[model samples]
Target: MSFDYDLFVIGGGSGGVRAARISAGYGAKVALAEESRMGGTCVIRGCVPKKLMVFASAAPAEAAQARGFGWEDATAGNFSWDAFKVRLDAELNRLEAAYTKGLEVAGVNIFHQRAHIVGPHEVELADGMRVSAKHILIAAGGRPYLPGIPGDDLGMISDDLFLLDRLPGRVLVVGGGFIACEFSTILNGLGVDTTLVYRGDKVLRGFDNDLRELLTMQLADSGIHVRLKQNPARLDKQGDQTRVTFEDGKVEDFDAVIFATGRAPYTKGLGLENAGVTLAPNGAVAVDEWSQTNIPSIFAVGDVTDRVNLTPVAIREGHAFADTIFGNKPHNLDHGLVASAVYTRPHEVASIGMTEDEAIQRGGVEIYDTRFRPMKSLFAGSDARVMMKLIVDEATRKVLGCQIFGPEAGELIQLVAIPITMGATKEDFDLTVAVHPTLAEELVTMRQPSRRHEAPAPA
Candidate 1:
């Protein structure tokens, strides 16, 4: 079929950009459209800016802890939100330019307008321009979701955090997910009176139970009022304060209420139905392992697919999709054993593979768990302890998973994922020499199993 381009990509996110660039590199005529910024969520409002905030928020605590290292002059003074915001905005602008430059270098036509499917092979841009292609890619990503409730508009979402002109004096963070927990900690460290309210019994619902419990204690110790089993019935603005009425009728007021409840796929207004593309019940675009939609010429990736919604995973999926269809290197991404890290105060949480609950559900398994105060914390007289756990298959002794909650947990997990992905066994880990004077050595030093469980026989 004759078309304007070989490929037309909607949403210049990590996934779409990677797909477009790689496809262009393969000598395919490509064009991409993004109504918003070029870098999408991660670069503009998500991981990039969020991590910078994490670093900024840690300054106070780190400065306070310096006293233990003989630096008597160290003190956490006033933080200027205005100053940080200026630098953050500049960094975002630089990053967006980089994304645009990369796309241009790859020979992909850039359109700074929203694009939606008008037909299986046709997309209409916001400027009333229609473009036809042999294939279409959707990588629109996701956005923070706010629940429908009375006066809910009074509350803010994660995106609002980056746009705040000034930091709130008192903040209420809603949700039990990583976003809620991370922001709660960040705000608390930044000297805001932070309160975290989650309807669930515990936060980080799907993570290892031990890690969740440890984090709960750490958060409370760090001065974040953790309220579990509570949800807001409504939110109302009252004279510069947000009044939150809980489902149980308890009322609390805060300078701001941020909802990190969850994110929904960004598939709206994309005209997927008109193009014969299927969408999941959660509004994510339905696609195969290779990211192909029901309509042969249409495909989706990244948060829009709701499959392992991490930036790196999305980029890999995009690269894989391009290689398979355009580069002539057919392959599919194995979504298993994807590692992730959550940046929280005092420590971080990271994991790869299955959780303890998941391992038990699979079959017989053995678990190794340990908790201790690291040398640095011990010297500082801090009560915070590090946690390390390994979930191993009883039958094969293969390490099915690993979880760590401590300083540099994220860095450790990245290296640990290499062996786990290669199917390393518990014995192999035990045989490895430990790196002394380090927290991660505990991973290799633990020789005894803390517990073992046998799965129930088939019913």
Candidate 2:
């Protein structure tokens, strides 16, 4: 007997759209529901818009450096915040329309409404319509979390920052995660007096310690007041300015306060409890290796389940889930060997797998690492630098992890991740010929183990 639908996906974010569209292509009847825009967090608020802002903020600095490259006079003039807002609005509208069109082109039924799980095989939409499917996938993504301070109403979350009516002259950024660091860098680069306040010692807490240190230095050098080991206690507004008081009695005044602290699973009103689906204590829909929920017919992916919150990771997980469940090709998502990048000024940080500290804790590990200034920076009189590290298991000789900090770190780490996930060894990198005049070549061309293990002979 044919079922109503092979798959029904909720949340039209990256994961939901990809899974719904791909599964439909495999002859599976698929229906996708999204209460918001199609592009999800990345396109609408998180990554794409944020990166565009970062690019806009860096243009002045780039133009200034272009003078050294032979231009007698290279000056970036005053930029209007309103002009940027207009451009961003037009671009975002186009992106959302494109995502919708893509899904429509894939022959997937798109429903623009809130979806709720009335049962394992049944879903109800906000418009009083219901649909039934063999499998229900939840990919609601995540929303920025605000601190529970006395005056949180006076501040904004990461989402609100993108749709602001006006740019603030002075902004206070709270949190220690990638979001906080990136927004702080972008705001400061755009000539805003940005003060980053974090409860941790550094901005990116779980990233490689070396990269964290280097990024901290770069942010500080760029004029961001890095306030560590501090927590926001309260906020007071006085005629358009917000004064943030820290738990330690430190006070900072700004035109706006941004809480980039963290995000929770976006399952607020999906009625998961009514459907007997298990959720983690933190409110994420619990899932197994195959993205299956406690209820066999229900599944979840992306930030909703509290796994790696990267856009690419979510896209991969969705594809794997669709392949495993509908495409008849069983697949399991391996979290290791996944690469990530932080968009910060002067230096970009990228990494796959464990850090040196983590490798040491695992025991019987060897780390080969290197640091140097980029060649292009030398002629430009720029102090920007690049660093790379390789972590390997001593006994097995299997490459366990890799991390890089510098220009194009994100671009360089992708190549390493493929071989690393394939279980390539340190000797494999040693034998590979270096790509001359490229920053990535430094990853494979290190002369010796900077910290652990022995040097290998060249190929």
Candidate 3:
């Protein structure tokens, strides 16, 4: 049976756009609908804009460090969020336009409206237009989740950070995850009196414990107040300020309260149930390795599937889905061993592979680690430490994980991910010659295990 289109994709995000474009490239007629901006969260709200802020936030500290290298000071007392916001908004507009243009160039019909699954092979747009296709793809991404507390709406989400007209004099940031830590680091660097309150004992809960411990210290050292085992019980707007009352009965006032708490799949009101698509309890669309849903005519990818939730991962998933279904080159995007980075200035972090906890659970593990004041920081008379760690399988001598928490950690980890993904052994890392007088050389130069755990004799 002929249809209006070959594929109907409900999101215009990184995944949806790539899928729609590639499917059309393979001569499949495609239509895509996006209720919001074409670039979705990454280009519009999450990574792109946030990373720019990370760069902007680093200026003050880097300038101070330069003076220590015998350069004269031409210091600015404060960062101008107003001036930066104008440029940031313009850049985002250019990106959104680029994404839309690319989709058009690829021959995908674009719909600037909301869409939801109405049938196994049909989608209904916000304008009440029902379109039928041979297959449907849901690439709708996730939304920032705000915990329900009294007057929580008075607080802001990470998306709101990019839109702020001015940076707050002081801000209270909530949550313990990467998003939380990242913004906290940015705000602190930007000279906002930033306080980070996490309900857990340490920040970055799922990362290697060494990273968690070092990052927590780094945040505190960089002048961000790290408050653990605490949570905001309520938030109240007091004129231009927010008065936060914590679970422990501590009250604090700040010009703003930002919640980088977490995000939930943006599947609400998408009418997935109408298509008989399975959904996880948190509302993420359930799909197989090939991204197909229970109903073969429908599929989901990207953050909507709640798998790996990174922009690169989403793009690969989209490419894999289109190639498998349309181009006849069947392959699944491997979710394992994907590298990620937190662009926190002065102490950025990048990591790949298992945490120490996971490695220990698998079998015997060996951990090699180092922490020291880097040459630059030492030259500047700052005692800030950089931490690098390797988690290795004791029995096989294979590197299980590589984590670095310091300057350029993100860039270094990207290169390290290549070797680790190729199943590089600890011996390989040890045998490699160290690059002289560089922070990254520590990764290759560590001679002995800091600790080792033998498999518990099969329990």
Which numbered prediction scores highest in TM-score against the true structure? 1
lDDT (Cα, tens digit) per residue for candidate 1, span 121-207: 999999899999999999999999888889888999999999999999999999988899889988998889999999888889999
How much lDDT does each candidate structure score? 0.92, 0.87, 0.90
lDDT of 3 at 338: 91
Question: Residue-wise lDDT of candidate 3 within 1-459, one digit each (tens)?
Answer: 879999999898899999999999999999999999999999999899989988988888888888888777746566777888899999999999999999999999999999988988888999999999999999999999889999999999999988887788899999888899889988888889999999999888888887888888878888899999999999988878899999989888899999988999999999988978889999999998999999999988999999899999999999999999999999998788899888877888778998877777766889898989999989987878888989998777889899899898989999999889999999999899999899989999998999887677854
- The C-alpha TM-scores of every prediction are 0.98, 0.95, 0.97
Candidate 2 residue lDDT tens string, 1-459:
355788999999898988888898888888999898888998999888998998898887787678778775887778788999999989999999999998888889999888999998999999998888999999999998777889998999999988888789988899878888889989988888899988888778888898898888888888999988888999998887998888998787889999998999999899898789998998999999899999999999999989888898889899998898878999978876678999887778888998876876666778788888878776778877778888888888888999889876777888788899899988998899998998888877875776763444456
The regions of model 1 sitting more than 4 angstroms off are none
RMSD of 3: 1.4
Q: Which candidate ranks first by lDDT, i.e. highest?
A: 1
lDDT of 1 at 102: 100
Model 2: what TM-score? 0.95
lDDT of 2: 0.87
Query: What's the lDDT for residue 65 in model 1?
Result: 76
